[model samples]
Target: MTYTFTCKKVPLSDSVKEYAQKRIDKLGRYFQDDPAVHVSFSVEREVLCAVEITIRSGSTILRSQSQAVDGDMRGAIDSGVAYIERQILKNKTRLAKRLRSEGFPSVVEDVSFAVKEEAEFDIVRTKHVPVKPMTAEEAILQMNLIGHGFFIFRNASDNAVSIVYRRNNGGYGLILADDME
Candidate 1:
């Protein structure tokens, strides 16, 4: 497995890298084959310690981003590790439910449980709307005018299909769709 660390805006010392490496190795037991792991540490305006870990195994991806309580990198790494572990555990539970009627006696050492959920979404209604070209602001405005959570439209800037949604906390989020190679 390859572990890559990206330090943004702050020069991470050797001690910090060593600390992060240990934390990352703790999660390595979950992968069967070599997986690509990317860890990024950054400092944002509101967030003191910004640590994000992304693990890519085959076609599956597990990511966790954590912020420390008081700009503590170790604490942030710990929290991120815990969060990703929980995610893995959750996926394992779901996969186990489908794999066997009875649960496993020990903790699973595989992370591919998240590869295929196998579960299907309950779809009751489907709608087809005309995708008109518009700017991000216009999409947000359309979403608000319709009192909908999200609005889908073609982007005027790039002519790509995009979605704009109202975030739970605040502000709006734009999702741009790209072609698959």
Candidate 2:
């Protein structure tokens, strides 16, 4: 597996690089031949340390990030890696389903999909769903009932359509699409 560590707004240190590489090495078992891991470290306001980890195997990509305000870069990196692993574990079922449904060939098959004609974007594959008029609260409820991260609907008040999605911080986010223009 190949590991790429990038540092931003922080001085590169051998200890820091070695520590990140060591942590990344633990993820090698998840892929064949030590999947390449991309690790990025950055400092913000000279107080907050951030670490991002990205692992890619074929078309499957898993990523996670973490931040620490106490200036603990190692802790931030470890936390980010752990969060990524947790995400992988949590989405294992969905990942397996996507692999099966999306024809994500077996790990043994190293064939590239770039040359395949079917790999191109297909308009017909786009799902056209109708947006019903409802309040943001209603959309949130519906999204929760359907176990979906997002729900699109027309606002009952203004008759404009919008989207409501779940946020990473256990909150809901809204995307308003104004047709007033």
Candidate 3:
């Protein structure tokens, strides 16, 4: 397994490394044989602290990133990890089917899904989305793996159509549909 840290504007400190270690350990089980961990820390305008964490396990890879507008690295890491956990729990079945890891949970419990009530307005609107269950993290990995600047996928989090693209800042950005009207 390899661990990599990238620092920009913000220096990687012992405390930050320690905190990152703690954070990644929370998702240790998800990692497979010889997993590679990459974390990027950056500061924008000397105010915002941004972090992007990428974990590669065998042929399966996922990336989760969080930014602290207040420039708190630790908080950003916590939020990023929480996002990953939620994604894992929500798509536990989907992920398990795709990724063969003993650390992955077998059952999908306490899952939440929205229920839309029928309306008798005689009008219904629908948009086509990729049925493949994938999160933003997977989208990014796929994008980079293919050497593409951007990639689009169905967001497993909210079932929203989303796009992940590379930014000029050496980081990635996600765009979600805001309005269909």
Candidate 4:
């Protein structure tokens, strides 16, 4: 796998770079094709060292970030890689399903990880609601009136489906679905 490293507010040493590359290269065993991996190192509050790793393969993206309490970049890198591995393990079955159903290129190798029995997720409730065409502002108002965190509606301007939700930062976020083509 190819690795691109970036440093922010911290001086990257040759040894640190080599260490990170070697550690991240171990993940290549899980993929059938080499994925592009980007790692960013940064120092926060002049004490905490942070590392963020992003792996991109075809249309799938895997990302994880970790901070070192002891200000060790290597530790942060290790933690980030471990987090990514856990994410891969947790979503292995879902990814395989997507590969079969959507025809997406498989980044993972079938032989690398053991396939374990996955817990079933049951859908207990189903609700059918009319998707009303409305502006984004009107959707937000409706969401607030209904005391719900999010409201899904058809955008009046484009007649496309959209979702408006209240953000944790006391703001609003809108998700508009567009054609990939």
Candidate 5:
């Protein structure tokens, strides 16, 4: 696995970088192969150190972030690496569930989990008279009525797609995708 280390507001040390790279490289033990990990270290408020680790393979992404108050940068890096490893384990359980649901054929030498792909087309489905604006509560009701997991509607305030969907806790969750230039 390849590791990329980037530092901000702090001088990069060879020892610190090597320690982080070696620590996260252990993630390969849980799976058949390891995915490349990206580590970003930054200093906020010139005192607290922040590290963000992102492991990506194709369409799948696993990320974890942590911060520490130690003056030593190596301590923060170690904490971040531990956080990332824990996150990967959590993701492994999720992958196991998906494999059980969709069926796992074989465990190859590479990343053992299979990635599912989905595509959406932008065409006319069932046209409506007017795209009415409503609150997230209304969207949840409409989604339940249509027997769909999610319902997208224009927010009366921002005119954006604010989605409401069923959660495993028997409650609804709202997704508000932001629009940025």
Candidate 6:
């Protein structure tokens, strides 16, 4: 996979970069095509290191981020990669369908799992609303006006369904649906 690294208020050494490349290269086995991997490293108060990794193939994206205490960059990187791996494992079937629909080769193989107890959430309520076409700004406005945490609508620009949500950090985030073949 191709890698692009960015450092925020932190300098990366050649050895660190090489280490990161080696670590991320191991993930290439999961993709038929080499995906673009973007990695960002940041330092917080000189005591913590944050690592963000994003893998992009066509319109699908898998991302993970982690912060390591005591400024351990390697640990942060490892944690981020593990998170992505877990995500892929959890959604392997869904990802395979998406890949095939998008004309991409499937990279996951079926594996038997040992039964284990897992937490479950009961559905308490369900509400359905007609998705209206609107710009992202309009969706954000509607979400704020309704005092709702998120609003769903069809994106005017792409004619695809989209979601606008209020972020915990006092900002809005947009999730656009990618057109698949």
lDDT of 1 by residue, 3-83 (tens): 899999878888988998888787666666677989999887745888999988755578999987566989999888888
TM-score of 5: 0.51
Q: Rank the candidates by lDDT, best first.
A: 4, 6, 1, 3, 2, 5
Indicate whether candidate 1 or candidate 5 has the larger lDDT.
1
lDDT tens digits, residue span 1-181, model 6? 8889999999989777788888888667667677999999999889889999999976678998899999789999888887876666665656655443343224434533322223354699999999998999999999989999999999887789899999864788998876575
Q: lDDT of each structure?
A: 0.79, 0.76, 0.76, 0.82, 0.68, 0.80
**Residue-wise lDDT of candidate 3 within 41-125, one digit each (tens)?**
9998888888888877755567887889877899998887777777665556556665555776555456453322233345488
Worst 10 residues of 1 by lDDT: 96-105
* Tens digit per residue, CA lDDT, model 4, 1-181: 8889999999988999999999988777656667899999999889999999999876677898899976799999988988877666666667654323333324446545443435766899999989999999999999999999999999999999999999864899999997652
Instruction: Write the residue-wise lDDT of candidate 5 on 1-181 in tens digits.
Output: 7788887887877977888877777655544445678988888888888888887654456677778886566777676666654454444445544222223324333643444322334587875545579988788788888799878788888888677888754888888877543
Off by over 4 Å in 6: 96-126, 132-138, 154-161, 176-181
TM-score, predicted candidate 6 vs. hidden true structure: 0.69
Q: How close is candidate 3 to the true structure, as a TM-score?
A: 0.57
After best superposition, candidate 3 residue 92: deviation in angstroms?
A: 1.3
Candidate 3, clashing residue pairs? none
Give the TM-score ranking, best first.
Answer: 6, 1, 4, 3, 2, 5
Off-target runs (Cα >4 Å) in candidate 4 are 97-118, 121-181
1 versus 4: better TM-score goes to: 1
Candidate 3 or 1, higher lDDT: 1
| TM-score versus the correct structure, for each prediction | 0.67, 0.53, 0.57, 0.61, 0.51, 0.69
- Can you list the residue pairs that collide in candidate 4? none
Clashes of 2: 0
Residue 173 error, candidate 5, Å: 20
Residue 125, model 4, lDDT: 100
